[model samples]
Target: MWSPWRIVGESLLSVAFGLLGAGLAALDHGGTVRIAAAGLAIAALSLLRRTLPASVLLVTAVGSVLFGGLAPLVLVAAWSAGRRIDGVGRAVGTFALAYVLNLGMAVVQALPHLSLPRLVFGVLWPLVAIIVPGLAGRYRSQHHTLTDTLREYEAQQQRERAMIAGQARARERQRIAQDMHDSLGHQLVLISVHAGALEVDRELTGRQREAVGVLREASVAAMHELREVVQVMRDSTEAPHEDRTTPGVAAAAAAAAEDTTALSRGVAGIEGLVGTSRSVGAAVKLRHSGEPCPLPPTADHAAYRIVQEGLTNAHKHAPGAPITVELRYEPDSLVVEVANGPATRTTDNGRGVVSGGQGLTGLGERTRLIGGLAHAGPTADGGFRLAGVLPYTSPEGGIPSPEPGNVTTTFVDPTNTFWQQTPGDSLDEGAPVMNGNGLKELAKAMSRKNGSGIAIGCGMAVLISLLLVIAALGVGGYFLLNKAEEARIEPKQYDTVKVGQPEAEIRKQLPKENSFVTDGLETDAPPVPKGAKCLSLTSTESSNNPDMEPVFRFCFKDGKLTEKKSFEVRN
Candidate 1:
């Protein structure tokens, strides 16, 4: 999966690391074999850092302990391991193992000349080379992951929003189709019934009777076509059977006919609906209560459909039953109810009045669209009731209101012994609550997956690194200042040293040996006396010229100071 440019870049980086490690080994006075080994190890580490970073890190850490020239490679390897590792546990474990190896080697190397400063440096050296670089790389990796996760989450949200909008549009179109089927189909059936009654009148001419028969046929045809269009508009699950007869058309046509009025779009139309049913020999009554309040056009239309559907169902299913239509206008809403008693006659009148079964469903949808609720079920006294609550003011943007009204009446079906509930009320109770809980659980899951522990670990690593840096600087500065003071001896102190003095006494009078200035002084200094040991020290007094410095030397033999010499050495 590596790109050509990335491969080229890695090759160049490997070569650079190899050359750099080799040069450092040469500068440290390593032999040819050691230099080559260091170069190859660094080159291998750079090449495999991405694919096998942990293995490369372990190898480099061991090399650093064995060869001082390869110490710098350990940091690079640790950084790579941190960045490439998948989880906190793996990255932390790998870095800890490397640190342990380096620390163990440092401890063994320093055991011969171990002091407080050397011990502290030994521990802190590995920490700086490993812990700090590892933490920084881990932080970088986590930041990149978090950023990518946020981008993907945003894109997913956008896609979900678009999908939801599309669903809303589809449901709206289905509602419109249902409205047409319920409202227009009812009016068309009434037209066919009235035309059928007129065609049988003996007072009309033969030609006029033919025209009325044609009109009735046309209305029936229109209803059939309307059903086809509504079925096409609906989803497959709700599509009605086209072959079933339209309810109330043939039965109402067979009953007595009466003068008809243009139906109102609101509560005022209930009287006309009842009158039509009465003409068809059904016992129906209309009752009104409270002062009528103005209603929005959508709510008004919904109220009318509820009554029409109720009357139609009653005429078709409960023949010879008495029906009542009630309209109560409350302070904020209009309540419409249609209740019918038990049937007195069976539906075997040879005029099939089978229900299409979508009337009440479409009525419910219409009521909900305009901030209303619909309910229909059998009553306690062997009867059925269809009821609805409509708000006086339509909701904004045609969206249903969460709470429709304060009216809380429950009707129980005698046969089923269950309460009839509105679709809006049931969905509000269950789906929203469940969806809210699901969203909360999803958020918690994401938080757990993203690893807050890694952030905490990185912070702890940074704090420890700072403390180690401060401790190392403090210890190093103390040793440096102490050594500078111990390495200098004054002119008076040097003069006080006597030749032939006991070595113990001479040592007490002289300052501590200055290893910094005297590390290889024997090779450049004048010849020493036979069977003698020498101690070298630098003078506190500076030479007048910058090119030279003064040094003091003492030789001991036979438990006495055998020789004392002072010289000016070139810088």
Candidate 2:
């Protein structure tokens, strides 16, 4: 390629050569005329290149040969032509002739007596100078130009590739708009109808009623925004204005500027979410372990929609399983997790839920725009999980819209009273029919009853036995002196029955004076029955229940009471 740079360089040299030629013609000297003629010839030679093919370079080289061998431009042209000429033999042959002509002229000019040779010498030497070395320079210049041209061509190819890829992206966005119109547009219309019906129909079941209202609002909003996007694509306008006439997403956004209702229209209360799922027979639980809080309005709306979409998928796909929603707050990040166990029913439509099959992807995009991230997929244990992380910095360096209406949150009191039966929740077979509150109360009641029963049993058993022992000791002591005579005669036999025998038996050995036994139902004491027999004690009871009835039914057999009894609470 002949660049402007090359043109400028050659043009400057031509102008200089032309000026030199004119100046030399003004001087009155033979050498000056010769030199001036050479300069003019060189300048004209440079001009020929602009109009002729590169082959004209050979003609320029001839001019250099006729002028001085110092003509650099001629040398460059000769060399360029030589390199471009493909056959090596032709290049060498042509260059060799130019060398001989100029060499012969130089040889003649040097021989002072040889006039013929002198004339020949001047002409031939110049020819030689412009051809041989000129040819070498032309070859070098041609190689350099070719390398530079190839580099520029490569750069151009890369630019074209990038342009094509950009065009492809624009085309894909158009295609995506078309797909959304076909699928999401219709589904949202159905959803709005069902939802609108639920709002006015008092006879609708609660679950259906709640679901339809949310679905209706969400569908209408989604359809409106979708249509807006489609319209933008259809029109191919750069600076886009959203259409806000519809009661859909775009419209709600426009309304939220001055209305709180608009903000909550497509939003589900986070608290009611779990309850709704439970009402539909799903065993669901919700727990938030953090500062009691909420999010900015835009983030709230975006996140709530994501959660709604996720749960709707769970219900649509894994309808029978229990779900757990956990919201954990870290110092720098807010995490939302929705996990559901596998479904047991055959009707589960466990597939992608959105019409575009890009709802989650859209959620992710929304998250990114707000400096957040969202992750969603099926879990390994026949379940699904959706997670999102909303960051603090938004994409456009702005905060998400503030939430409308302050939250009036309530904290749970630990000691709140409760019941033995919960109206609804997880069912237990043998477990007490209670919530956490009932379990606490029942525990306290059982503890009280057990302590009382233990105290009564221990108190009664020990006291009666101690009284009998003391009476026997007293009677036996009185008999001890009398028994001294008996012991002297029967020492070994008395010792055998002393330590290991029952106290009742020991009491019987008290000469029948201190021995007392109770019989069933007929003790003489008012509280004790008479018939069978009775032992009366005048000592006050040490037990707290001093009004207790005496245990009258103790039967004795072979010097031991075989049956014993205690007071009964009722009659």
Candidate 3:
């Protein structure tokens, strides 16, 4: 819908264009009524721009046939229709109609003298008038639509972030309640136990016994209330399956299951795993050194995961190779090492079995969380080795606890940045390394999306080339003009010479060969008559628009000039 102000603005624009068109028509000897009629028609049609833009454009296009001044108003209405209309089909239809009408009118008006070439040239104005405004309007519409979409997307993202933050706060509150129940509920239970023991004392007065009974009753009541509190906290923290009401629960459950399975199947079953591998036609051996120490749960988990991952690598990469698993317990550290010999033959159905290559990466992440280091690489021999070192006890003589506030995590996609060897890197390298190929690919993708950047670069190159050419031409022109001005000329001698003058006489009257002749033109003139010779002389002009030097020709017949004329070099 067009506002009143907008309608007025459109009217003003239409009238202004009408006046301009009338002025142009007046230049072509149009009458005052014709000019006034065109102006009034444009102003009237523009009033229907908002509600009936297509209809307005049609009428204005037709009107332009009678008053050629109304063409601008026709274009304006076409543009408005294209911008305001809902469907591209309708706008395109309107554009086509206007084009046909305008062309038909032109053809009708000039039917007496229309030719293929003239018709083509006449068709160009209407074509451009229809298409350019339509395209511009289409671009404006698309731009606005895109801007609206981006704004909506940004608003949606903000809402999503607020929702996620609220969810995190709720989860945190639940976690706090659960922790209180876990840590404080036991202390309350101990108080209830002690009060019960006092209540049952063998030696006591009636009042003392009564007091003890009261104390025990109160303690029991408190313990019951505490249990209720603990139960409520547990219920809140662990919502029932039907009441979970959250996304990612299934993924969380699956990840927990995987972790539990890996822990159970990793370090605890090392010997069994080795025996199982041997049973499956793999030559494997396990060895232990140093006294076995009671390792922390985290250390044991890390150690087990390292050996499990190493054996898995052997199975996948070095199939049929003899593998050795070594567990060494130092005074402070426990090390797990797995090595394999060169692959003897294909132990699986397929050759070069493709792997997602994340087994070692996950293992590394797990070990690092518990203050351990993991390494894997090719061995000096045609084989592979995997090694890990986990500290059984931290320097503080206790298991290391994860510090939540001070931890920063950077996730590396294994598919993109595959592990690569670094300078002096050993088989125990655990730090993530980015692949060079991935970075180059990312850069190329970014460049491809930047169309304006590429266009600007090409434009700059062309501009620089143009400037250089202009500078070179300027310097060369300056030197040529300076040399031409400095050269001397014998004007009187050449002016007095006759048309049949002798070649020797003309040569003597000419300036020094090194002076004026340098800028003069030299060319072979037309052949002289029988037994005659031809001569040419070149000289610069004395004018503001001096260009090429002029050449003077002379025909010498029997040692005398016959004909002479001057010609300027064209280019």
Candidate 4:
């Protein structure tokens, strides 16, 4: 779309017309013809948008005005540049360049019209043009910087999240390796050591020797595989690749895929895992217990890994054990279960091989990562059993598929985890709720147990607030009782006072006891008897309670003392 030849042609045309206009404007002592030519050049330059850029457009617009090239060109160039680019960087760059060029030209043009006041407006107006866009461009620059900073911060957060995830995965793998070495390594050593001693005994028959040899081979293979895994982990990135087998669930799954990146093949690829076990003298039979259904991606991965690890452990620990793996697909999840019986006596191995016991732990980690559950341990009836339940997500991305038209909606308890349910199990409410979110529920249960202390403290605080409120109410009640007792005049005089009388007039109506030798009982002597008031009763008689000191009381007209009979005893 952007042709170099077309761009060159546009530039040459623009330069030619601009020079021609300059010649006409110089010869005619004016610029009417030049203005017309510049307008024509601008129109042609605009037509070359996809091919040519603002180089031609700038020149074309400026040449259109003889002495006033500054304003016309800057304005037109800004308008043209807006339609040229989408990015802020380019737009600001174009605007800034135009501002500088326009302001400089304006100064040159105004030099000839130099009067003190005229030059001021001339320079100031052009400064406005230059500064306005420059200020706008500054804001654009700061805003662009902020956007870039935010994007960088987001990318940094993603990297940190990935790093934390990787670290957690690595730690899990290390723990798995340690468990394998500790538990399963000792078993394999016993098999190898006892078999080597039995091989030396002369009482062994030929068939017995062959079985022992197979046992030794299987044990050594498992030990070496475990060793290779440990070495690979010791310095993960640089470990030798010569003995690399399927490292984890993901690698095993990928090795079994025709195209590992594609999600369609799924658990079907686990046949490859079965083939690996059969080579190691283990017979692994894969079967389906229930009618299979379309499985969610999480269910698919969990099913594959559970079966693969079960078979792997069978081959490593119980070489001649007949292992059976059953998978069942349900509406909400997929269930995978693997069981192996005790070693058979057909070939009569000296001792069964047993490697590190990380198979079960690794399987558990894989299940938990995708909201699934896994269990693996020795079975009550001889060999071992492995089970996992993987919850499904809707392909539409949010909710699960609705119950089928023919099917009744049933809820299952999460903790009731079963790879395949028995025919006797009635689909009921919350039966599987415990097992489905067992890990999460375990954490919540612990938190609830721990928060009992905080709950007690909260109860204590509430109790203290209640006690304070009761104490404050008791204090208020005592104050109210004192006020009522002080206001006990004769019952007939209780309603005598009107409500609207002033406190000063009520005080004057009460009696007081005073030994008025000179002026008044007030501490401050006034020009007049300012503190004096006529009283219906003496202050001493008004204080009827002997326990109370003599105090002033202000009485109402009929006889009620409207003011308190409280003491003014000075120390």
What C-alpha RMSD separates each model from the true structure? 11.1, 61.0, 22.1, 33.5
User: How high is the CA lDDT of each candidate model?
Assistant: 0.69, 0.48, 0.58, 0.49
Give the 10-residue window scoring lowest on summed lDDT in candidate 3: 249-258
lDDT of 1 by residue, 1-571 (tens): 9999999999998888898999998987789998998788788878888899998888877778777656777788788887888877987788899888888887787665455766677788878888798888888888788766766764554444333333333344455566676667667656655665576679999999889878877876786788777777665423223211121111111110111222235666767788887886678889989998977666776777888888877755676789999999899899999999998765333443434456877776556656678999999999999999998876553443223221111121222111111123221112221122234444455657675676777788799899878989898779866765687789998898888889999888776454443455555579888889888887889988786778789999989998999987765
Candidate 2 error regions (>4 Å) = 1-105, 112-308, 318-334, 341-356, 360-375, 379-383, 389-571
Model 4 misplacement above 4 A: 1-222, 234-287, 296-304, 314-324, 341-354, 369-371, 380-383, 391-571
Q: Which whole-number lDDT from 0 to 100 does residue 403 have in model 4?
A: 27
Candidates sorted by lDDT, best first = 1, 3, 4, 2
Models ranked on TM-score: 1, 3, 4, 2
Q: Global CA lDDT of candidate 3, please?
A: 0.58
- For residues 10-55, write the lDDT of model 4, one tens digit per residue: 6675565455544555554556766676545544554553344456
Most TM-score-accurate candidate: 1
Any runs in candidate 3 off by more than 4 Å, and if so which? Answer: 1-8, 21-35, 203-571
Between candidates 3 and 4, the one scoring higher on TM-score is 3
Worst 10 residues of 4 by lDDT: 426-435
Query: TM-score for all predictions?
Result: 0.66, 0.32, 0.42, 0.32
What is candidate 3's TM-score against the reference?
0.42
